[model samples]
Target: MRDFSCFSENGVQVADAASSSNASITTSSSKIGQNLVTCVYQCRLRNFSSFIITITWTKNLMGQGVSVQIDDSTNQCLCKVEIKPWLFTKRRGVKNVEVGSKLIDIHWDLASAKFGVSPEPLEGFYFAIVVNQDLILMLGDMVKDAKNKIDASGFAPNVVFVSKKEHIFGKKAYSTRGQFCGKGKVHDIMIECDLMGTNDPCLLIRIDGKTLMQVKHLRWKFRGNFTILVDGLPVEVYWDVHNWLFGKLMGEAIFLFQTCLSAEKMWASQSILEPSWSGSLHRDPHTQGLGFSLVLCAWKNE
Candidate 1:
Protein backbone atom coordinates (compact mmCIF):
# COMPACT_ATOMS: atom_id res chain seq x y z
CA MET A 1 0.00 0.00 0.00
CA ARG A 2 1.20 3.54 -0.73
CA ASP A 3 1.25 6.38 1.76
CA PHE A 4 -0.74 9.62 1.60
CA SER A 5 0.00 13.06 2.97
CA CYS A 6 -2.68 15.32 4.38
CA PHE A 7 -2.54 19.04 5.05
CA SER A 8 -4.91 21.89 5.77
CA GLU A 9 -5.63 24.72 3.37
CA ASN A 10 -8.16 27.40 4.27
CA GLY A 11 -9.62 25.13 6.97
CA VAL A 12 -10.22 22.25 4.49
CA GLN A 13 -8.01 19.21 4.83
CA VAL A 14 -6.45 17.99 1.61
CA ALA A 15 -5.35 14.41 1.37
CA ASP A 16 -2.89 13.69 -1.42
CA ALA A 17 -1.53 10.32 -2.35
CA ALA A 18 2.22 10.20 -2.70
CA SER A 19 3.57 9.72 -6.16
CA SER A 20 4.55 6.14 -6.93
CA SER A 21 5.85 4.30 -9.94
CA ASN A 22 2.84 1.94 -9.96
CA ALA A 23 0.16 4.50 -9.22
CA SER A 24 -2.98 3.63 -11.19
CA ILE A 25 -4.19 7.22 -11.07
CA THR A 26 -1.75 8.29 -13.77
CA THR A 27 -3.02 7.23 -17.21
CA SER A 28 -0.75 7.24 -20.23
CA SER A 29 -1.74 8.67 -23.60
CA SER A 30 -2.22 5.27 -25.20
CA LYS A 31 -4.48 4.12 -22.38
CA ILE A 32 -6.28 7.48 -22.19
CA GLY A 33 -7.45 6.97 -25.74
CA GLN A 34 -9.33 3.83 -24.74
CA ASN A 35 -12.78 4.06 -23.20
CA LEU A 36 -12.82 2.27 -19.84
CA VAL A 37 -15.07 2.13 -16.82
CA THR A 38 -14.33 0.12 -13.70
CA CYS A 39 -16.87 -0.39 -10.94
CA VAL A 40 -16.10 -1.98 -7.57
CA TYR A 41 -18.55 -3.71 -5.28
CA GLN A 42 -18.35 -5.31 -1.85
CA CYS A 43 -20.27 -8.56 -1.60
CA ARG A 44 -20.70 -11.45 0.79
CA LEU A 45 -19.72 -14.91 -0.27
CA ARG A 46 -20.28 -18.29 1.37
CA ASN A 47 -20.27 -18.44 5.17
CA PHE A 48 -20.88 -14.72 5.24
CA SER A 49 -17.33 -13.96 4.16
CA SER A 50 -16.80 -10.57 2.57
CA PHE A 51 -15.18 -10.11 -0.82
CA ILE A 52 -14.55 -7.35 -3.31
CA ILE A 53 -15.62 -7.66 -6.92
CA THR A 54 -14.27 -5.42 -9.67
CA ILE A 55 -15.93 -5.25 -13.08
CA THR A 56 -14.17 -3.34 -15.81
CA TRP A 57 -15.69 -2.53 -19.22
CA THR A 58 -13.47 -1.64 -22.13
CA LYS A 59 -13.95 -0.45 -25.69
CA ASN A 60 -11.09 0.10 -28.11
CA LEU A 61 -10.09 -0.52 -31.68
CA MET A 62 -10.74 -4.23 -31.49
CA GLY A 63 -14.17 -4.15 -29.87
CA GLN A 64 -15.95 -4.08 -26.51
CA GLY A 65 -15.16 -6.39 -23.59
CA VAL A 66 -15.60 -6.90 -19.88
CA SER A 67 -13.56 -8.40 -17.05
CA VAL A 68 -14.62 -9.61 -13.64
CA GLN A 69 -12.24 -10.13 -10.73
CA ILE A 70 -12.93 -11.27 -7.18
CA ASP A 71 -10.63 -10.57 -4.27
CA ASP A 72 -10.76 -11.82 -0.72
CA SER A 73 -10.64 -9.63 2.35
CA THR A 74 -6.87 -10.00 2.50
CA ASN A 75 -6.49 -8.34 -0.89
CA GLN A 76 -5.59 -11.66 -2.47
CA CYS A 77 -7.13 -12.22 -5.88
CA LEU A 78 -9.41 -15.21 -5.69
CA CYS A 79 -10.32 -15.46 -9.35
CA LYS A 80 -10.49 -13.40 -12.54
CA VAL A 81 -12.42 -13.85 -15.77
CA GLU A 82 -11.72 -11.80 -18.86
CA ILE A 83 -13.94 -11.69 -21.93
CA LYS A 84 -11.57 -10.51 -24.57
CA PRO A 85 -12.75 -8.06 -27.19
CA TRP A 86 -14.38 -9.74 -30.20
CA LEU A 87 -15.13 -8.07 -33.48
CA PHE A 88 -18.30 -9.89 -34.55
CA THR A 89 -19.19 -12.65 -32.16
CA LYS A 90 -22.10 -12.23 -29.77
CA ARG A 91 -20.85 -10.15 -26.83
CA ARG A 92 -21.89 -12.67 -24.20
CA GLY A 93 -20.85 -15.97 -22.64
CA VAL A 94 -20.36 -17.88 -19.40
CA LYS A 95 -17.22 -18.95 -17.59
CA ASN A 96 -16.82 -21.26 -14.62
CA VAL A 97 -13.81 -20.38 -12.48
CA GLU A 98 -12.45 -22.37 -9.57
CA VAL A 99 -11.56 -20.29 -6.55
CA GLY A 100 -9.90 -22.34 -3.84
CA SER A 101 -12.34 -25.24 -3.42
CA LYS A 102 -15.43 -23.45 -4.64
CA LEU A 103 -16.65 -23.27 -8.19
CA ILE A 104 -17.72 -19.74 -9.12
CA ASP A 105 -19.86 -19.33 -12.20
CA ILE A 106 -19.78 -16.10 -14.11
CA HIS A 107 -22.55 -15.35 -16.59
CA TRP A 108 -22.93 -12.38 -18.92
CA ASP A 109 -25.27 -11.65 -21.80
CA LEU A 110 -24.62 -8.51 -23.84
CA ALA A 111 -26.01 -9.67 -27.15
CA SER A 112 -28.54 -6.88 -27.07
CA ALA A 113 -26.74 -4.50 -24.76
CA LYS A 114 -27.42 -0.85 -25.38
CA PHE A 115 -24.66 1.71 -25.03
CA GLY A 116 -24.43 5.42 -25.40
CA VAL A 117 -21.08 7.13 -25.84
CA SER A 118 -19.44 5.19 -22.99
CA PRO A 119 -18.12 1.68 -22.97
CA GLU A 120 -20.38 0.55 -20.16
CA PRO A 121 -23.73 -0.84 -21.13
CA LEU A 122 -26.73 1.36 -20.60
CA GLU A 123 -29.18 -1.56 -20.47
CA GLY A 124 -30.28 -4.76 -22.26
CA PHE A 125 -27.60 -6.85 -20.54
CA TYR A 126 -27.04 -9.03 -17.52
CA PHE A 127 -23.82 -9.88 -15.68
CA ALA A 128 -24.06 -12.30 -12.82
CA ILE A 129 -21.70 -14.01 -10.41
CA VAL A 130 -23.00 -17.17 -8.84
CA VAL A 131 -21.51 -19.15 -5.96
CA ASN A 132 -23.11 -22.41 -4.91
CA GLN A 133 -26.36 -21.61 -6.71
CA ASP A 134 -26.61 -18.25 -4.95
CA LEU A 135 -26.17 -15.06 -6.88
CA ILE A 136 -23.41 -13.08 -5.25
CA LEU A 137 -23.43 -10.08 -7.56
CA MET A 138 -25.47 -9.00 -10.54
CA LEU A 139 -25.50 -6.01 -12.89
CA GLY A 140 -27.38 -4.65 -15.87
CA ASP A 141 -31.14 -4.56 -16.45
CA MET A 142 -32.00 -8.12 -17.37
CA VAL A 143 -32.42 -9.49 -13.87
CA LYS A 144 -35.27 -11.83 -14.79
CA ASP A 145 -33.32 -13.36 -17.62
CA ALA A 146 -30.28 -13.77 -15.41
CA LYS A 147 -32.26 -15.60 -12.73
CA ASN A 148 -33.90 -17.91 -15.24
CA LYS A 149 -30.57 -18.73 -16.85
CA ILE A 150 -28.83 -19.32 -13.55
CA ASP A 151 -31.86 -21.22 -12.16
CA ALA A 152 -31.62 -19.19 -8.98
CA SER A 153 -34.29 -17.81 -6.71
CA GLY A 154 -35.62 -14.31 -7.01
CA PHE A 155 -33.85 -12.27 -4.37
CA ALA A 156 -31.68 -9.24 -4.34
CA PRO A 157 -28.04 -9.91 -3.63
CA ASN A 158 -26.57 -8.00 -0.74
CA VAL A 159 -23.87 -5.85 -2.23
CA VAL A 160 -22.47 -2.40 -1.68
CA PHE A 161 -21.22 -0.27 -4.53
CA VAL A 162 -17.73 0.84 -3.61
CA SER A 163 -16.28 3.09 -6.30
CA LYS A 164 -16.15 3.81 -10.01
CA LYS A 165 -13.24 4.86 -12.21
CA GLU A 166 -13.58 6.11 -15.76
CA HIS A 167 -11.53 7.82 -18.44
CA ILE A 168 -13.06 10.86 -20.18
CA PHE A 169 -11.59 12.88 -23.02
CA GLY A 170 -12.29 16.24 -24.58
CA LYS A 171 -10.58 19.38 -25.79
CA LYS A 172 -11.77 21.74 -23.07
CA ALA A 173 -14.88 20.23 -21.51
CA TYR A 174 -15.68 16.75 -20.20
CA SER A 175 -18.95 15.32 -18.95
CA THR A 176 -20.20 12.15 -17.28
CA ARG A 177 -22.89 10.77 -14.97
CA GLY A 178 -22.45 10.11 -11.26
CA GLN A 179 -24.45 8.81 -8.29
CA PHE A 180 -23.10 10.13 -5.01
CA CYS A 181 -24.99 7.90 -2.61
CA GLY A 182 -26.85 4.62 -2.73
CA LYS A 183 -30.21 4.87 -4.51
CA GLY A 184 -29.51 8.56 -4.99
CA LYS A 185 -30.35 10.47 -8.08
CA VAL A 186 -27.79 10.18 -10.83
CA HIS A 187 -26.65 13.61 -11.86
CA ASP A 188 -24.80 14.84 -14.91
CA ILE A 189 -21.32 16.04 -14.03
CA MET A 190 -19.55 18.47 -16.32
CA ILE A 191 -16.00 19.76 -16.00
CA GLU A 192 -14.80 22.67 -18.10
CA CYS A 193 -11.30 24.12 -18.38
CA ASP A 194 -10.31 26.38 -21.26
CA LEU A 195 -6.53 26.43 -21.28
CA MET A 196 -5.93 27.00 -24.96
CA GLY A 197 -4.07 30.25 -25.63
CA THR A 198 -4.61 31.38 -22.06
CA ASN A 199 -1.96 32.09 -19.47
CA ASP A 200 -4.34 31.77 -16.55
CA PRO A 201 -7.00 29.12 -16.94
CA CYS A 202 -10.09 28.66 -14.83
CA LEU A 203 -11.74 25.40 -13.80
CA LEU A 204 -15.49 25.11 -13.74
CA ILE A 205 -17.60 22.21 -12.45
CA ARG A 206 -21.31 21.78 -12.94
CA ILE A 207 -23.81 19.24 -11.68
CA ASP A 208 -27.08 18.75 -13.54
CA GLY A 209 -26.26 21.81 -15.65
CA LYS A 210 -25.93 23.95 -12.55
CA THR A 211 -22.57 25.56 -11.88
CA LEU A 212 -21.53 24.39 -8.44
CA MET A 213 -17.84 25.21 -8.12
CA GLN A 214 -15.30 27.33 -9.97
CA VAL A 215 -11.59 27.82 -9.49
CA LYS A 216 -9.65 30.66 -11.10
CA HIS A 217 -5.91 30.97 -11.64
CA LEU A 218 -5.82 27.23 -12.17
CA ARG A 219 -2.15 27.35 -13.03
CA TRP A 220 -1.38 28.41 -9.47
CA LYS A 221 -4.02 26.29 -7.76
CA PHE A 222 -3.73 23.31 -9.99
CA ARG A 223 -4.19 20.91 -7.10
CA GLY A 224 -6.98 21.65 -4.65
CA ASN A 225 -10.37 20.54 -3.29
CA PHE A 226 -13.75 22.00 -2.49
CA THR A 227 -16.99 20.86 -0.92
CA ILE A 228 -20.54 21.13 -2.25
CA LEU A 229 -24.00 19.94 -1.31
CA VAL A 230 -25.71 17.31 -3.39
CA ASP A 231 -28.88 15.41 -2.50
CA GLY A 232 -28.63 16.93 0.97
CA LEU A 233 -25.21 15.40 1.50
CA PRO A 234 -21.75 16.92 1.43
CA VAL A 235 -19.55 15.86 -1.46
CA GLU A 236 -15.84 16.69 -1.44
CA VAL A 237 -14.35 17.39 -4.85
CA TYR A 238 -10.60 16.99 -5.27
CA TRP A 239 -8.68 17.73 -8.44
CA ASP A 240 -5.04 17.53 -9.47
CA VAL A 241 -4.44 19.29 -12.76
CA HIS A 242 -0.67 19.65 -12.53
CA ASN A 243 -0.31 17.43 -15.56
CA TRP A 244 -2.86 19.35 -17.59
CA LEU A 245 -1.08 22.58 -16.80
CA PHE A 246 2.58 21.61 -16.98
CA GLY A 247 3.09 17.99 -17.85
CA LYS A 248 3.66 16.27 -21.18
CA LEU A 249 1.45 16.78 -24.21
CA MET A 250 -0.64 13.65 -23.64
CA GLY A 251 -0.74 13.89 -19.89
CA GLU A 252 -4.14 13.69 -18.23
CA ALA A 253 -5.68 15.33 -15.17
CA ILE A 254 -7.50 13.62 -12.26
CA PHE A 255 -10.72 14.56 -10.57
CA LEU A 256 -12.27 12.75 -7.61
CA PHE A 257 -15.79 13.22 -6.33
CA GLN A 258 -16.07 11.62 -2.90
CA THR A 259 -19.26 11.40 -0.85
CA CYS A 260 -17.93 10.46 2.56
CA LEU A 261 -20.21 11.47 5.38
CA SER A 262 -17.55 11.92 8.05
CA ALA A 263 -15.11 13.39 5.61
CA GLU A 264 -13.92 16.10 7.96
CA LYS A 265 -13.45 13.64 10.79
CA MET A 266 -11.67 11.20 8.53
CA TRP A 267 -9.37 13.95 7.39
CA ALA A 268 -8.70 14.96 10.98
CA SER A 269 -8.11 11.43 12.15
CA GLN A 270 -5.96 10.54 9.17
CA SER A 271 -6.40 6.88 9.97
CA ILE A 272 -6.63 5.64 6.39
CA LEU A 273 -5.41 7.34 3.27
CA GLU A 274 -7.49 7.68 0.15
CA PRO A 275 -6.64 4.50 -1.69
CA SER A 276 -6.47 4.17 -5.46
CA TRP A 277 -9.51 2.94 -7.35
CA SER A 278 -7.83 -0.34 -8.29
CA GLY A 279 -6.40 -1.09 -4.83
CA SER A 280 -8.92 0.32 -2.34
CA LEU A 281 -11.70 -2.27 -2.52
CA HIS A 282 -10.47 -4.33 0.42
CA ARG A 283 -10.95 -1.46 2.86
CA ASP A 284 -14.74 -1.48 2.22
CA PRO A 285 -15.49 2.25 2.34
CA HIS A 286 -19.23 1.55 2.45
CA THR A 287 -19.00 0.15 5.98
CA GLN A 288 -17.80 3.43 7.38
CA GLY A 289 -20.48 5.32 5.52
CA LEU A 290 -17.62 6.69 3.46
CA GLY A 291 -19.98 6.48 0.49
CA PHE A 292 -19.00 6.15 -3.13
CA SER A 293 -16.14 7.77 -5.05
CA LEU A 294 -16.16 8.64 -8.74
CA VAL A 295 -12.71 9.06 -10.26
CA LEU A 296 -12.39 10.74 -13.63
CA CYS A 297 -9.12 10.68 -15.55
CA ALA A 298 -9.71 13.62 -17.86
CA TRP A 299 -7.59 13.69 -21.00
CA LYS A 300 -7.22 16.27 -23.72
CA ASN A 301 -7.98 15.22 -27.27
CA GLU A 302 -5.20 16.26 -29.62
Candidate 2:
Protein backbone atom coordinates (compact mmCIF):
# COMPACT_ATOMS: atom_id res chain seq x y z
CA MET A 1 0.00 0.00 0.00
CA ARG A 2 1.73 3.15 -1.24
CA ASP A 3 0.91 6.62 -0.06
CA PHE A 4 -0.84 8.79 -2.62
CA SER A 5 -1.08 12.09 -0.69
CA CYS A 6 2.42 13.09 -1.77
CA PHE A 7 2.37 12.19 -5.49
CA SER A 8 4.33 15.21 -6.70
CA GLU A 9 7.95 14.93 -5.45
CA ASN A 10 8.51 11.12 -5.73
CA GLY A 11 8.30 10.84 -9.51
CA VAL A 12 4.94 11.68 -11.12
CA GLN A 13 5.06 11.10 -14.88
CA VAL A 14 5.15 7.47 -16.21
CA ALA A 15 5.31 7.68 -20.00
CA ASP A 16 8.38 6.63 -21.94
CA ALA A 17 10.77 9.31 -23.26
CA ALA A 18 11.19 7.70 -26.67
CA SER A 19 8.62 9.79 -28.52
CA SER A 20 9.05 8.01 -31.83
CA SER A 21 9.36 4.54 -30.33
CA ASN A 22 6.13 4.70 -28.30
CA ALA A 23 3.15 4.06 -30.56
CA SER A 24 -0.35 5.50 -30.52
CA ILE A 25 -3.19 2.90 -30.66
CA THR A 26 -5.64 5.06 -32.61
CA THR A 27 -6.73 4.12 -36.12
CA SER A 28 -7.39 6.45 -39.08
CA SER A 29 -10.92 7.17 -37.84
CA SER A 30 -10.92 8.30 -34.21
CA LYS A 31 -14.11 6.48 -33.13
CA ILE A 32 -12.16 3.42 -31.98
CA GLY A 33 -9.50 5.10 -29.86
CA GLN A 34 -11.21 6.23 -26.68
CA ASN A 35 -11.19 2.85 -24.94
CA LEU A 36 -10.06 1.81 -21.46
CA VAL A 37 -9.70 -1.39 -19.45
CA THR A 38 -10.23 -1.69 -15.70
CA CYS A 39 -9.32 -4.51 -13.29
CA VAL A 40 -10.80 -4.61 -9.79
CA TYR A 41 -9.31 -6.41 -6.82
CA GLN A 42 -10.57 -6.92 -3.28
CA CYS A 43 -7.65 -6.53 -0.89
CA ARG A 44 -8.12 -7.24 2.82
CA LEU A 45 -6.09 -4.79 4.87
CA ARG A 46 -4.84 -5.21 8.40
CA ASN A 47 -7.62 -2.97 9.73
CA PHE A 48 -10.44 -3.29 7.19
CA SER A 49 -11.77 -6.65 6.13
CA SER A 50 -13.08 -5.34 2.81
CA PHE A 51 -11.02 -2.98 0.71
CA ILE A 52 -11.24 -2.55 -3.03
CA ILE A 53 -8.58 -1.38 -5.46
CA THR A 54 -9.31 -0.46 -9.06
CA ILE A 55 -6.53 -0.26 -11.63
CA THR A 56 -7.52 1.42 -14.88
CA TRP A 57 -5.36 1.34 -18.01
CA THR A 58 -6.06 3.99 -20.61
CA LYS A 59 -4.68 4.68 -24.10
CA ASN A 60 -5.53 6.90 -27.03
CA LEU A 61 -3.99 9.30 -29.58
CA MET A 62 -2.02 10.95 -26.80
CA GLY A 63 -0.38 7.91 -25.16
CA GLN A 64 -0.78 5.35 -22.35
CA GLY A 65 -1.69 6.20 -18.76
CA VAL A 66 -2.49 4.39 -15.50
CA SER A 67 -4.78 5.31 -12.57
CA VAL A 68 -5.30 3.60 -9.22
CA GLN A 69 -8.25 4.13 -6.86
CA ILE A 70 -8.65 2.56 -3.43
CA ASP A 71 -11.92 2.24 -1.55
CA ASP A 72 -12.65 0.90 1.89
CA SER A 73 -15.46 -1.41 3.02
CA THR A 74 -17.89 1.50 3.10
CA ASN A 75 -17.10 2.22 -0.56
CA GLN A 76 -15.39 5.46 0.41
CA CYS A 77 -12.33 6.38 -1.62
CA LEU A 78 -9.23 6.42 0.57
CA CYS A 79 -6.68 7.55 -1.98
CA LYS A 80 -6.17 7.93 -5.69
CA VAL A 81 -3.03 8.05 -7.86
CA GLU A 82 -2.86 8.94 -11.53
CA ILE A 83 0.25 8.63 -13.73
CA LYS A 84 0.23 10.69 -16.88
CA PRO A 85 1.21 9.32 -20.29
CA TRP A 86 3.80 12.00 -21.05
CA LEU A 87 7.17 12.85 -19.48
CA PHE A 88 8.61 9.38 -18.99
CA THR A 89 11.19 10.67 -16.51
CA LYS A 90 9.10 9.37 -13.57
CA ARG A 91 8.35 5.95 -14.97
CA ARG A 92 9.85 4.14 -11.99
CA GLY A 93 9.45 5.64 -8.51
CA VAL A 94 7.80 5.39 -5.09
CA LYS A 95 5.19 7.35 -3.12
CA ASN A 96 4.51 7.44 0.60
CA VAL A 97 1.29 8.55 2.26
CA GLU A 98 -0.21 8.51 5.75
CA VAL A 99 -3.70 7.11 6.33
CA GLY A 100 -5.36 6.51 9.69
CA SER A 101 -1.99 7.51 11.27
CA LYS A 102 -0.16 4.67 9.49
CA LEU A 103 2.53 5.25 6.85
CA ILE A 104 2.21 3.37 3.55
CA ASP A 105 4.58 3.18 0.61
CA ILE A 106 3.76 2.29 -3.01
CA HIS A 107 6.49 1.40 -5.46
CA TRP A 108 6.15 0.76 -9.20
CA ASP A 109 8.47 0.04 -12.13
CA LEU A 110 6.88 0.40 -15.56
CA ALA A 111 9.97 1.56 -17.45
CA SER A 112 10.68 -1.91 -18.82
CA ALA A 113 7.07 -3.13 -18.68
CA LYS A 114 5.95 -4.83 -21.86
CA PHE A 115 2.54 -3.71 -23.11
CA GLY A 116 0.18 -5.54 -25.42
CA VAL A 117 -2.70 -4.11 -27.49
CA SER A 118 -4.09 -2.60 -24.29
CA PRO A 119 -2.38 -0.11 -22.00
CA GLU A 120 -1.80 -2.76 -19.27
CA PRO A 121 1.53 -4.50 -19.30
CA LEU A 122 1.71 -8.19 -20.17
CA GLU A 123 4.88 -8.87 -18.18
CA GLY A 124 8.30 -7.45 -17.18
CA PHE A 125 6.94 -5.06 -14.55
CA TYR A 126 5.85 -4.85 -10.92
CA PHE A 127 3.78 -2.75 -8.49
CA ALA A 128 4.43 -3.20 -4.80
CA ILE A 129 2.86 -1.94 -1.59
CA VAL A 130 4.23 -1.62 1.96
CA VAL A 131 2.16 -0.57 4.97
CA ASN A 132 3.90 0.33 8.21
CA GLN A 133 7.12 -1.01 6.65
CA ASP A 134 5.47 -4.39 5.97
CA LEU A 135 4.84 -5.72 2.45
CA ILE A 136 1.09 -6.02 1.87
CA LEU A 137 0.54 -6.65 -1.85
CA MET A 138 2.52 -7.17 -5.02
CA LEU A 139 1.28 -7.10 -8.66
CA GLY A 140 2.70 -8.24 -12.00
CA ASP A 141 4.82 -11.30 -12.78
CA MET A 142 8.17 -9.94 -11.60
CA VAL A 143 8.09 -11.39 -8.07
CA LYS A 144 11.82 -11.55 -7.31
CA ASP A 145 12.44 -8.04 -8.62
CA ALA A 146 9.47 -6.74 -6.65
CA LYS A 147 10.52 -8.44 -3.41
CA ASN A 148 13.91 -6.80 -3.65
CA LYS A 149 12.17 -3.44 -3.47
CA ILE A 150 10.20 -4.32 -0.33
CA ASP A 151 11.22 -5.11 3.25
CA ALA A 152 12.64 -8.58 3.84
CA SER A 153 10.52 -9.44 6.91
CA GLY A 154 7.19 -8.55 5.30
CA PHE A 155 5.07 -11.38 3.90
CA ALA A 156 2.53 -11.43 1.06
CA PRO A 157 -0.72 -9.53 1.40
CA ASN A 158 -4.13 -11.20 1.25
CA VAL A 159 -5.64 -10.30 -2.09
CA VAL A 160 -8.46 -11.55 -4.31
CA PHE A 161 -9.08 -10.55 -7.95
CA VAL A 162 -12.75 -9.61 -8.12
CA SER A 163 -13.83 -8.29 -11.51
CA LYS A 164 -12.88 -6.62 -14.78
CA LYS A 165 -14.49 -4.10 -17.15
CA GLU A 166 -13.37 -3.07 -20.62
CA HIS A 167 -14.74 -1.10 -23.56
CA ILE A 168 -14.46 -2.96 -26.88
CA PHE A 169 -15.11 -1.45 -30.34
CA GLY A 170 -15.97 -3.20 -33.58
CA LYS A 171 -18.36 -3.10 -36.54
CA LYS A 172 -20.07 -6.50 -36.33
CA ALA A 173 -17.54 -8.47 -34.31
CA TYR A 174 -15.98 -7.41 -31.01
CA SER A 175 -12.88 -9.13 -29.64
CA THR A 176 -10.98 -9.19 -26.33
CA ARG A 177 -8.84 -11.41 -24.11
CA GLY A 178 -10.17 -12.55 -20.72
CA GLN A 179 -9.01 -14.83 -17.89
CA PHE A 180 -12.08 -16.17 -16.09
CA CYS A 181 -10.37 -17.92 -13.18
CA GLY A 182 -7.64 -16.55 -10.98
CA LYS A 183 -4.40 -16.61 -12.93
CA GLY A 184 -6.29 -18.81 -15.36
CA LYS A 185 -5.50 -19.30 -19.00
CA VAL A 186 -6.26 -16.24 -21.06
CA HIS A 187 -8.86 -16.93 -23.78
CA ASP A 188 -9.78 -14.88 -26.82
CA ILE A 189 -13.41 -13.69 -26.59
CA MET A 190 -15.28 -12.88 -29.77
CA ILE A 191 -18.78 -11.47 -29.95
CA GLU A 192 -20.56 -11.26 -33.31
CA CYS A 193 -23.82 -9.36 -33.79
CA ASP A 194 -24.93 -8.37 -37.28
CA LEU A 195 -28.13 -6.30 -37.17
CA MET A 196 -27.38 -4.25 -40.28
CA GLY A 197 -30.60 -4.77 -42.24
CA THR A 198 -32.13 -7.96 -40.96
CA ASN A 199 -35.37 -7.73 -39.04
CA ASP A 200 -34.36 -10.54 -36.66
CA PRO A 201 -30.79 -9.88 -35.59
CA CYS A 202 -28.64 -12.56 -33.95
CA LEU A 203 -26.03 -12.61 -31.19
CA LEU A 204 -23.14 -15.03 -30.89
CA ILE A 205 -20.37 -15.30 -28.29
CA ARG A 206 -17.23 -17.35 -28.81
CA ILE A 207 -14.21 -18.40 -26.80
CA ASP A 208 -11.04 -19.17 -28.71
CA GLY A 209 -12.87 -19.16 -32.07
CA LYS A 210 -15.29 -21.87 -30.91
CA THR A 211 -18.93 -20.84 -30.54
CA LEU A 212 -20.07 -21.33 -26.98
CA MET A 213 -23.42 -19.58 -26.99
CA GLN A 214 -25.74 -18.05 -29.58
CA VAL A 215 -28.97 -16.11 -29.37
CA LYS A 216 -31.44 -15.65 -32.23
CA HIS A 217 -34.33 -13.17 -32.40
CA LEU A 218 -32.27 -10.85 -30.26
CA ARG A 219 -35.00 -8.19 -30.12
CA TRP A 220 -37.09 -10.07 -27.57
CA LYS A 221 -34.18 -11.76 -25.86
CA PHE A 222 -32.17 -8.58 -25.58
CA ARG A 223 -31.91 -8.79 -21.81
CA GLY A 224 -31.47 -12.15 -20.17
CA ASN A 225 -28.98 -14.59 -18.61
CA PHE A 226 -28.04 -18.21 -19.02
CA THR A 227 -25.54 -20.74 -17.75
CA ILE A 228 -22.59 -22.22 -19.65
CA LEU A 229 -19.58 -24.39 -18.88
CA VAL A 230 -16.02 -23.26 -19.38
CA ASP A 231 -13.08 -25.39 -18.26
CA GLY A 232 -15.54 -27.63 -16.37
CA LEU A 233 -16.86 -24.77 -14.21
CA PRO A 234 -20.26 -23.14 -14.50
CA VAL A 235 -20.24 -19.57 -15.83
CA GLU A 236 -23.30 -17.32 -15.81
CA VAL A 237 -23.67 -15.04 -18.85
CA TYR A 238 -25.97 -12.04 -18.93
CA TRP A 239 -26.48 -9.62 -21.80
CA ASP A 240 -28.28 -6.34 -22.54
CA VAL A 241 -28.26 -5.35 -26.20
CA HIS A 242 -31.33 -3.15 -26.24
CA ASN A 243 -29.22 -0.18 -27.26
CA TRP A 244 -27.27 -1.83 -30.03
CA LEU A 245 -30.44 -2.54 -32.01
CA PHE A 246 -32.50 0.65 -31.55
CA GLY A 247 -31.12 3.06 -28.96
CA LYS A 248 -28.75 5.60 -30.58
CA LEU A 249 -26.15 5.71 -33.30
CA MET A 250 -23.04 3.76 -32.31
CA GLY A 251 -24.81 2.39 -29.28
CA GLU A 252 -23.05 -0.19 -27.10
CA ALA A 253 -24.26 -3.54 -25.78
CA ILE A 254 -23.51 -4.69 -22.23
CA PHE A 255 -22.42 -8.26 -21.54
CA LEU A 256 -21.50 -9.68 -18.15
CA PHE A 257 -19.97 -13.04 -17.38
CA GLN A 258 -20.00 -13.99 -13.72
CA THR A 259 -17.32 -16.57 -13.97
CA CYS A 260 -17.08 -19.29 -11.25
CA LEU A 261 -20.01 -17.90 -9.20
CA SER A 262 -17.65 -17.66 -6.23
CA ALA A 263 -18.84 -14.30 -4.99
CA GLU A 264 -21.97 -14.59 -2.82
CA LYS A 265 -25.22 -16.50 -2.57
CA MET A 266 -27.27 -13.31 -2.96
CA TRP A 267 -26.19 -12.87 -6.58
CA ALA A 268 -28.32 -15.83 -7.50
CA SER A 269 -31.31 -13.56 -6.88
CA GLN A 270 -30.42 -11.30 -9.83
CA SER A 271 -32.08 -13.69 -12.26
CA ILE A 272 -35.59 -13.05 -10.89
CA LEU A 273 -34.85 -9.36 -10.53
CA GLU A 274 -38.11 -7.46 -10.71
CA PRO A 275 -36.72 -4.49 -12.63
CA SER A 276 -34.22 -5.93 -15.03
CA TRP A 277 -31.09 -4.01 -15.99
CA SER A 278 -31.66 -1.61 -13.15
CA GLY A 279 -28.29 -2.21 -11.59
CA SER A 280 -28.26 1.35 -10.21
CA LEU A 281 -29.90 0.54 -6.88
CA HIS A 282 -27.84 -2.62 -6.51
CA ARG A 283 -24.95 -0.64 -4.99
CA ASP A 284 -26.07 -0.71 -1.36
CA PRO A 285 -26.80 -4.37 -0.66
CA HIS A 286 -24.12 -5.82 -2.93
CA THR A 287 -21.27 -3.41 -2.41
CA GLN A 288 -18.64 -5.52 -4.11
CA GLY A 289 -21.29 -7.80 -5.61
CA LEU A 290 -21.03 -11.58 -5.51
CA GLY A 291 -19.03 -13.11 -8.37
CA PHE A 292 -15.98 -12.31 -10.45
CA SER A 293 -17.69 -10.21 -13.13
CA LEU A 294 -16.30 -9.69 -16.61
CA VAL A 295 -18.22 -6.74 -18.03
CA LEU A 296 -17.80 -5.97 -21.72
CA CYS A 297 -19.30 -2.80 -23.15
CA ALA A 298 -19.35 -3.66 -26.85
CA TRP A 299 -19.52 -0.64 -29.15
CA LYS A 300 -20.49 -1.00 -32.78
CA ASN A 301 -18.68 1.17 -35.36
CA GLU A 302 -20.74 2.42 -38.28
Evaluate all candidate structures by whole-model CA lDDT and list the values in order. Answer: 0.72, 0.67
**Which candidate ranks first by TM-score, i.e. highest?**
1
Give me the candidate number with maximum lDDT.
1
The per-candidate count of clashes, in order, stands at 0, 7
Give lDDT tens digits, candidate 1, residues 1-302: 01122222332332122212232222232222439998898888557877789999999888988888888877788998788636657567788887767778888888898986688988999989887667788898998887678855445887888888888887777877767765677677778888888887889777766566778778767776677777776788777788788887767788877887675554445422332332332335435677787888888887
List where candidate 1 sits over 4 angstroms from the true fold: 1-34, 264-287
Q: Candidate 2, clashing residue pairs?
A: 1-129, 1-130, 2-105, 2-106, 3-97, 15-88, 263-290
Q: After superposition, how far is residue 114 of candidate 1 from its true place, in Å?
A: 0.7
Candidate 2 C-alpha lDDT tens digits along 64-183: 778887777778887888875344567788878788965667788888888765677788888876667756567888888777776634567777777787888877777777777656
Against the hidden true structure, what lDDT does model 2 obtain? 0.67
Range of the 10 consecutive residues with the lowest summed lDDT in candidate 2: 11-20
